[model samples]
Target chain A: MTEASDTLVEEVQARFDDLTILEYEFDNVEIELARKANALNAPLYKRRAEVIAKIPHFWALVFGRAPPEVETYIQPSDEKAFALYLDTFEVIHFEIDDPKGSPRSFSLKFGFKENEYFKDKVLEKKFWFRKTSDWEGLVSEPVKIHWKKGQDMTFGLTDAAYALAQAKKRLPPGNTDKSKERALPEYKALADKIEESEESSASFFALFGFVSSWRYVSAEESGKIRQTEAENLAKVKRGELVEEPDSDEDNENDEDDDHDYQETEVFPGGDEVAILIAEDMWPSAIKYYKRNHDDDDSDDDDMDDVSVNDRANENDDDSDEELDIRALVNKGRKEPTSNSPPMPPPARKKQRKA
Target chain B: MTEASDTLVEEVQARFDDLTILEYEFDNVEIELARKANALNAPLYKRRAEVIAKIPHFWALVFGRAPPEVETYIQPSDEKAFALYLDTFEVIHFEIDDPKGSPRSFSLKFGFKENEYFKDKVLEKKFWFRKTSDWEGLVSEPVKIHWKKGQDMTFGLTDAAYALAQAKKRLPPGNTDKSKERALPEYKALADKIEESEESSASFFALFGFVSSWRYVSAEESGKIRQTEAENLAKVKRGELVEEPDSDEDNENDEDDDHDYQETEVFPGGDEVAILIAEDMWPSAIKYYKRNHDDDDSDDDDMDDVSVNDRANENDDDSDEELDIRALVNKGRKEPTSNSPPMPPPARKKQRKA
Candidate 1:
């Protein structure tokens, strides 16, 4: 190694420190921008919720036309459930104004009518902005879904995961090692169940039971960790402490990977799925709903432009279009001509004949 | 298709319109945030420029340690030129305050000492925020390089591209059709040159002569296009105009592809490269410079922990580390012990012997 001039090294370090400070300022500006945007969006979102309430199956149609990122996770059974019972949907930036919390923390609330699928009137999943030893982002716990009888859309996967999580919670403090926890009957049952099922067959309802691939930390724990990190950073800045190197931590991470049940097996890319739903699908609900109308107009225009006049040709075109989820959901579903559909589980006429 | 309830459709459209308005507000918030961040960053950047100037070969070392996204574009000769002649670097968000302009518009300004490479003291390449029929982004013209005889790093490629661009500029307004333009002598010469050369071996200096793959529009033209679009949108909102269908536009794009000299043939992903440099590299220069030092300390620590002691073993380790750009740049090169190196092109002792 070459000998670096002491003063030159200090100069470079000083510049690096200044750049770090500038980054801190930029982060503050982003947080401020989020707070301001949220204030302006609140009233408009409230108005939208009221307007969308009067339109029957509005959310259903929106989900039908959802972007592939979200649609890829929805099973055939999930679509049926959505068409039958899904109602008002909302996303709340719950920590936008909390000084100690991040704007990234948000809640996806889904209101549903009394359906045979689940007992909860409102299934709300919250993603808390979290930072751990080597990872940082939004993390969530499995939301319990009370399914009636044999009506579990996710088959028995969600049920098993939820039961295992409960059993783990009951373990005594300081005795919750990974091997010990896995030995529990509930954990063994869930593991065996997961081993037997094909991940591709899992329903979108499995998302309700999705937890982080890494260790799940509560919001309170995340906040405390952040505070401790801040303190440690300040100490280093003041030259009162030296940062510890995690040279052997890689081995521990590898061990964790060996036994960990990655959330992807059940709900592939669950974090990204939840994020897309909250950030895009929820905010642009109306856009997706209106997109179906545009698609229908374009399809008809293409057929006419191509001079498809035969009845048999038209029937073939209809069959091809039926493969699109939007077509299946809106096939013969009549818009509410008189009063809106009842708040309770009104029998939704099956629109998909195919 | 089933008949859509008129009032219900109207209700959905109205909500969509409201959401669009909210999006407009959100866009305004983002612009305001940029303005504020720029105001804060301006002074810090100025301080950085001054501090970096005092450290000789500062930008050179930083470029040597550039992230892979930037490093992949830089040829071996580019590194030699940077080590010998590149002095200071600055990125300017030139359109941050322009009412009709976008903050995305930025300039990559390189300050170079008098060298055998090019005549320019300051090579300023500006990317104007532009919009065309099917694209919106920062677009730039081929910046002419006044290169010394027999010293053209891009091997006459930049010369050919610059000549063709200049010739195209002189074409009559309506006669600038692509097919006819491609038949021009300068264009034919450039086409032949590109056909013969391996893009992988092209010098990074070609970035100076890069143009957008899409039709390049000046900021003035972009502002006019935006104004017209806004007016058309207003008319549509007021029920005074019907939006035209763009069913044939796709076919026109295919036609454009036939004769267009896609910039990727010269510089693959030039747009993304410029964006990442301006947005990531420029703002985080100090971080990259310091990262090399951290890498060195870690490497040494690993050697000690693994009990590497033999002198021949140490020699082998040094040979393996030679491939690292940081090692090549810093190898046995004594830091400025007395005065910083001169501003002009000083003879930098060649550090890469491998």
Candidate 2:
């Protein structure tokens, strides 16, 4: 073995003697730990119970077999139940709410057998808590689930589940109806009015072209940069969309007017072309422009254009971050019909859907 | 107290009994006990030891002082310690590959202390494992971590640290070809198509418009309809595009003009006006279209024309779904150099800056 391998083995031998994975006496202890730590701003996300309590129809997936532990609060008759069982485990980890005074989060995750005939079926439960729990309830509702044998969905949910648990346990209000409405543009427009708007940078054109993809630029996605036209310009001036454009169109042929993202017979007017061109290459185009477009100090251009857009997205994620079960327990759902968009970071979850 | 109160009290009293949690023994056996009854297919996850190895920083955040556990890999002298710490957590939680046969996920989640000293600290660690470990190596690299709390960063890695204890991980292949250029539009001429092409279900246009908050509609958006546009007639004559117009514009518009969404704003010039307008009312608009417009027959023709735009950016809360770990891990980085657009349901994460 190489020297590194030898050293690694030695280190491994040493650690085996020192480290031990601690399991809490009960999942509730994790909640207690989180409450103590979150007062100082710690990360405490432990799935208090292994599953989501409300899954309208869990047994249907498994056909006639429902795991034993899956008690019927309301089991649909068509679905199958393997058995009734309440297997429990101690959760030791916690998600930090603040991150400062809190130590580290550790919780116990346990699985309850839900159905055997459906194969190795069980209701998975994770117990998580955070410092925010001190003010309200301690543990989050059980997030119950059913998955195929060897097809656990936790990979997508583990971090996301806890992130949300902790955030909900920690952060305050941000997502609102007004905010949701402006999330797309009004509240998020990068707010960079180029003062010299005289000569646009190559990046500006690049970004504009990129956004065109969303608009549907079909003719030349490969290598051609279609030239912008006059009628399209007037429409743009009037705030009308034209067509989706390709980036590689040669500028030399601008006067020839035959070459444009919408130049072909596809569109009847210039407005439709711009829309296609605009949406396709935006994010990258925006990045490039933000990197190079600020030469002539524009109006209120202090904030990076990309940053503004990013901030909006980040703020949106924040809602994902603050979905604390502690808070949920403290406050009853106000608007039953409307659900808040989760502010994530704290809310990033492992989803099987993706 | 009422019976409900008595039950609550009994539950609380039982909880106070300090029952052991996860490690609860069944017949004095150390192995996990099967709940009293039944079975169904449900998976469980456990974090690899290596993930726990780098959590010193997480511990530090809660305690206001990192545990000796973290010191070996991240020293006070290393400014990258915080970054490294978060990176470790992010890497382990979000990137661990989903191998075939191993579907459940394991991640460590912990609790925070409720004090001021360790503000923003990490209290506990929850280890989550996913079902895809079998496929990790095919898509991603093995994580390299310094195991010994006292190990020197400048020194080489130890074998123990690189053991199979590491979770196999994968990076979603978001095709990125930087050398490729964006397509720019022939902005000026795209306007004509706005006036001539087909139009979509008015509701789709309205919803898209509302969501994007397109204060006003431009002809470009209005240029094409799902059915047929006059320009397509010309295109068919020229054999430019494949499908011919289903019917002439005047003929189709005769019966469908009423299909415009309730919220669209016609552009100044009749030339270009946006038609697909589903926004804040997306769910409703689609529902309405599905039930009223199509019912069964006419729906097929207009379905393609419904332009439902993702007007509002959905920030994933990591709500156990639609997660992007790379973004979550490198959240501290000013910007992550990612190339793919965020996906629906679960998001594709931003990549490391090369």
Candidate 3:
């Protein structure tokens, strides 16, 4: 064996010993452990065992599965990390982590070098989250990882770590407040305009599409907002709540405040709030233009052209970095907020059927 | 109003009356109904009510919402069906069904024209299944329909009909005997070959991927098969059950019979069985080839070339049609046979990490 291969074996061996001790300690404390103990151990044991098993599997595949003269090197970086170099073109990194104080909780990261095997053959990165109740010793359903273009090589690894951390409520340092406040009057006015508009059902839906594509609001959330606004309007008609209709001066003041806030507040990852504000104002702008041209039916064509041009300019200003913000917003929406099963990722705009 | 619009109103009015009768009949039979009455009525009432509400919403969005000069027409085809033609290229079809005997059970189909409004805007076709017990009148989680390329526009409608029919045990006529017999010896041989192979952890996983992609076997089912095979092998080792190892002649006879069976049996919808058989034999074929070439290191390159060529040939023979069969197989595996929450769809192959 090469020196690198020797180091890999030694490193894996050391981690294997640590895992064994952890398992033993877990067994001893089984009775005293909390309910989470089982949850933690379920993934931990499976991951550690998988990592240990992968060492021999990697070697066998590299040597026995491939050509014999295809030179390879394997090395251990630390007790918890190892690397496999497949000639000069490819490398595989394997890392196993069990945060010091967490029992029965572990994560495994397997990194593949971007090579022919990955480019043409490998489709997705998969991580198994073995359920604690799987007594049959079968690996449970896996969590699949899809690599987006321009994603970092360690994207899957970091995501796994983040998922585990979130599960354990130990997520990395970040601002806890992610929620943004909406100006109720502005939302109410938009809802009213939509209700009164002579635009076709198709146009109404098109407006929704523009909003969803430009803002953080999901299709589901947008529906909820519409329903809420509708219900609130009904209540107002029934005199169930006092209405404080804002004057034109108040509305202008609110818009200026919103614009200033959008300019000043930099959302850490993306400007979702700014986009939301922009989309929230979009319908009003159209309504204003329509009211001015209400007497001239022929002018509708000019209105459409203007709006299309404006949208094109907006697209031009929104860089790829900003587009990625939409992905982040989608990810944030997927995080489970309650005991309920996570709502399937917000339906993509491309999948909508009117 | 035009004659078409009058007919549309008349048809909807008739269905609305039938729905009202159904609701009243349901109320009369409430005390005699089983506990499942509530559960059944939950989605039923909400869907019925939404359909009713949508009538006004639809009319308002069509005539009231659109420009007066847009030139629209609406007509009813039957008591339970209607259509709205918005100009030349756009049409919307609405259908409501309450199979005569199934009280408090209904389905609504909303069809959209494949116009500009739909082209770049519509994503998922959504139907809300609201529970009657929900006092807040919040729309429950929506059931989304994704249209596959070349799929019928009314696929969602037909699928919903099928689901309701299945629930009511009123499915359309067809031969019901769908189960196939398993050839245990072949499975045992395959399992034995995998266990004896030196391909390590990777081989074991390849075995799983092969099983998952090929058979109706789930991860859980694969685990059970492995456990059973391991135990049987142990018993054989201990000289318990007579091995009755197949002689060369017996193996040849079995192969001939298997080939004849494959030629005769036809699977409805698609030949999933044939594909399964092909994929099931894939790994074993590779293993056999590898075993034969094991002693000669220089032959490795040749083996790789042969395997790659074989795989390419297989790919050429397997059309997109058969690839879709794999998806269907995975879907079948996800549907729980017993009383359990439906397992999420099988993780797609593109999402696999390793």
Please, what is the whole-model Cα lDDT of each candidate in the order they appear?
0.62, 0.24, 0.25
State the lDDT of candidate 3 residue by residue for A122-167, as single tens digits: 2222111121100101111122334355432332332332233233
Best by TM-score: 1
iRMS (Å) per candidate: 14.5, 33.0, 35.3
DockQ, all candidates in order: 0.13, 0.01, 0.01
| Chain B structural similarity as TM-score, candidate 3 | 0.16
RMSD of 1: 9.1
* Candidate 3 or 1, higher DockQ: 1
Q: CAPRI verdict on model 1?
A: incorrect
lDDT of each residue in B1-354, candidate 3, tens digit only: 346544543343233223223333333333223223333333433433343342212221222212222212111111011122122111111111221122222222234345321232232211111111001011111223343454323323323322322332332333121221223333333334434432322210011111111112122322333344345445534434323223332222223222222111111111222222222221122122122122222222222222111222222222332233233223324442321111111110111111
Better of 1 and 3 by lDDT: 1
After superposition, the stretches of candidate 3 with alpha carbons farther than 4 Å from their true spots are A1-44, A47-54, A57-354, B1-230, B233-354
lDDT for residue B220 in candidate 3, whole number 0-100: 32
The better-scoring model by TM-score among 2 and 3 is 3
Fnat per model, in the order shown: 0.09, 0.00, 0.00
Which CAPRI tier for candidate 2? incorrect
Tens digits of lDDT, candidate 1, A19-38: 44454555666577678667
The weakest ten consecutive residues by lDDT in model 2 chain A span A129-138
Q: By summed lDDT, which 10 consecutive residues of candidate 2 chain B come out lowest?
A: B36-45
